[model samples]
Target: MSERVIAPKSRGFLFLDSHPTGCRRLVDEMWQAVPEPVPAGGEGPVALIIGSSAGYGLAATIAGLARVGIRGIGVCFEKAPARRTGTAGWYRTAATARLARQHGRDMVFLNGDAFSDTMKEQVAGLLAERFGGRLDFLIYSVAAPRRTDPDTGHVHASVLKPIGSPCTTKTLVFDDDGAPEVKEVTTPPAEGDDVEQTVAVMGGTDWERWITYLDDRSLLAEGFATVALSYIGSPLTAGIYRQGTIGAAKSHLEATARALDERLGKALGGRALTSVNAAAVTQSSTAIPGIARYVGLLRGVLGDAMVSPTGQLVELWDQLTGDGPLVLDEEGRIRLDTWELDPAVQDAVAERWSVATSDTVPELADLDWFGDEVRRLYGFSVPGVDYSAAVDTEVAWPTRIN
Candidate 1:
């Protein structure tokens, strides 16, 4: 691997994010993707958006509100208040909420957990009081694996351990060498509390729970539409996600889509939609062991990866907002992950892996210009900043529901 200068982690270029203009560029791309106008600018119904702080939740809130004109309410589950600097989602939500409020949009922020009964009760009450129990959308966009199981009251931790025996494959970082390095990853088997526990935490249980409660309380609107995100990445994620406990849990989630479609579709006038969303580099995915380095090395191997230049993980975020060409709907459910798993793409990536090794330096061929984009997401690797810039450090949440 060639040594690129280590970039400091802090605000570098954009006012809020290093690449402010670059961020807008990505947003514009999303704006272009919704061929059918995703209407916005309204004050009619309510939109309960879980995980609206960052990731898909944030994109959904923006897209659904900006283009679709779902000018309803936004319910965010953020525990950033408990943390000093607050969560990344905190600032993103604040910036968007501020912009929305200035434009006469109805928006609300909450610093609470979405998996708790108390949180549910409070949000439900808010919706009832504000929108008269008329919520048109319920977006279950959360992606956390750590939650307290309501049934057992046990704090469950999701596992990424593979189901069967460990598997090994060649890893790619360089292609100059004629041969590749034989790298094997051993995924431990999840037994006892691992499998069941992981399922309880990441499966459709919480999603089902939320719908049942909302319906029982007569909170859902007549044409209510609900969507939950799911993904099955290519073999690149096999060592970490596939053949692991998390994979098992994901399977559980994938299965729930059908059942939820059946139940929610009937209840919501056949508008329950499940999208196996696109796969790209994500914050959560980046942090997983081996994935970060793999992605980094991939940037060198895949020449097409582009940098945001404005401190945003542009490509990944675009996919999350359903603003890309890869999304294809079968009936109503969208196959967003299909592109990531395309045989040709996977074959090309794997073939590169077979020919790359530590002894040889990899060339940028398939990677896009997404390096700066990925780095900007964490407020790093951006250009045109003092690096010693300062701030008041006294920003407050636009709305605190706790």
Candidate 2:
């Protein structure tokens, strides 16, 4: 394959092509941010990270390898480079595998649909053969538009709409000049089985199934634990996010975590819980209606206090593997969004939300920083990356299972 300089091809927040070298640089920075590993008695923890290509999943994988010294297996679905550039997650995963090798850690990337029985079976066999047949931890961080039921073969698609009534909220849209412009977006309520389908796709059914499948094959370790990433925005975004169809799905996920906690407790002295993470610029979050505006305002208010997804997951590893007891909320979840939900932070964001306009929002929120972060997600505006230099896009995952 010949090398060529690849610029970002995006419409709104949807990016089509990714730069491999820039993605590798971002992965390297994330690895560098990881603190020194805590002492693991043996070969560290063996973990299975589903949806481990981008966002919190990718962060968790890096933290586990560099901070917790884990031997990990990652499962994600991504398109490889062909006529066009490959997806950002593809390059990120390959870079992470390379990082694992550099540190002499065992890491495997499986390129396939993680919500399928075949992939689950393949991971189980890999665990038995290559990972010593014991899984210490399972991290679930999948965010997809649709999911096909492994048992019934029904396709469920998730929708980002309100549940009861239409929601009209103030949001931000990038204009022709690449500056954020204030706009009002109205999303209609869920119709027919929209809520149910959203729940089916984004719910904890697949998470539960993965655990059951692995447990049936005796793959869980003595002190096994599992965590699924979730979010509960403040009342500002409640109408469209927390009170919407996705909220219904998140409710199911939390309930599943409780039930799994009970089951794991009785079976192998294990645990299951959800980690409510903070908002950040992610490919999935960009699709939500008011998330962009909220995140911008959040960054403006929180400023240096805002924690990136990688930082949050690094702290999570400390809490999970530390000597002290786990600090949980009233609902048995690890609250990683405390900073974002602080009263002072929310008050400031609300004040800006009330009076923000296309002309005034530039002064109220750090839209320029937000734009740079979004571009970095696609490996376009990362620091120290030469966009003019021709680079090969055909990067391969060194330990891909499929």
**Judged by TM-score, which candidate is best?**
2
Each model's number of backbone clashes? 36, 0
Error of 1 at 296 (Å): 5.4
Q: Write the per-residue lDDT of candidate 2 for residues 289-358, one digit (tens) a residue.
A: 8889989988888777899888999888888886336889999999999988999889999999899898
Q: Clashing residue pairs in candidate 2, if any?
A: none
TM, every model: 0.76, 0.97
Q: Global CA lDDT of candidate 1, please?
A: 0.56
Compute the lDDT for candidate 2: 0.90
> Over all chains combined, what TM-score does candidate 2 have?
0.97
